[model samples]
Target: MSHAEIEIERRDRVTHGDYIAKLDTSDSTAKLSWTDRQGVRHAEHTFVPPEARGKGVAEALVKALVADARQEGFKIAPDCSYVERYFDRHKDLSDLRA
Candidate 1:
């Protein structure tokens, strides 16, 4: 099935705690994080509201993070289980995996 049409962008800055990324739609929002270790960006944490689940917000967030990492020449560590599986399901995105 086709996923939602998600728009991705680099966060200008981190404001709220526990939120490294975000996905906002007409009716919902999702928060996420790109895990960093020893000055290296590794993985991410994605949280989609229960009501927003199954709409592909998490997938889009993971995809965005992967693209960002690749653009910056970094590898992914995937601390989030869902993010890891997202990569497993989409080989094109695995280039970011550490």
Candidate 2:
């Protein structure tokens, strides 16, 4: 349950995308999902399994998403409740908000 053991990956489709966080030593995973429209990334949902709860899996997923947003030059619409709170906590990334 350490952040160092978590590896996050992005999966993008035609109109939607997801960030998947996997633990290198286990089968556990966490996910954050979003849709794209007119260049805005609509963050819609985040799912962290019960076993992975309180272990920073969701945080890793969100961080990966935000990193991609910054590197890809895209804005994010925080439709997911978790993402909304994340953004609220980190005002430094407000420039990436949609």
| TM, every model | 0.69, 0.91
Off by over 4 Å in 1: 1-5, 12-28
Worst 10 residues of 1 by lDDT: 12-21
Q: What are the runs in model 2 whose C-alpha is more than 4 Å off?
A: 24-28
The all-Cα superposition gives candidate 1 an RMSD in Å to the true structure of 3.9
Q: Give the per-residue Cα lDDT of candidate 2 at 57.
A: 87
TM-score (C-alpha, index-matched) for candidate 1: 0.69
Each candidate: how many clashes? Answer: 2, 0
Q: How many backbone clashes does candidate 1 have?
A: 2
User: What's the distance in Å from true for residue 95, model 2?
Assistant: 0.6
**Which residue pairs collide, candidate 2?**
none
lDDT of each: 0.63, 0.88
Model 2 sits at a Cα RMSD from the real structure of: 1.5
- Per-residue accuracy of model 2 over 1-98 as CA lDDT, tens digit each: 67777878889996998899876545866799999999999999999988768888888888888988889899999999999999999999899999
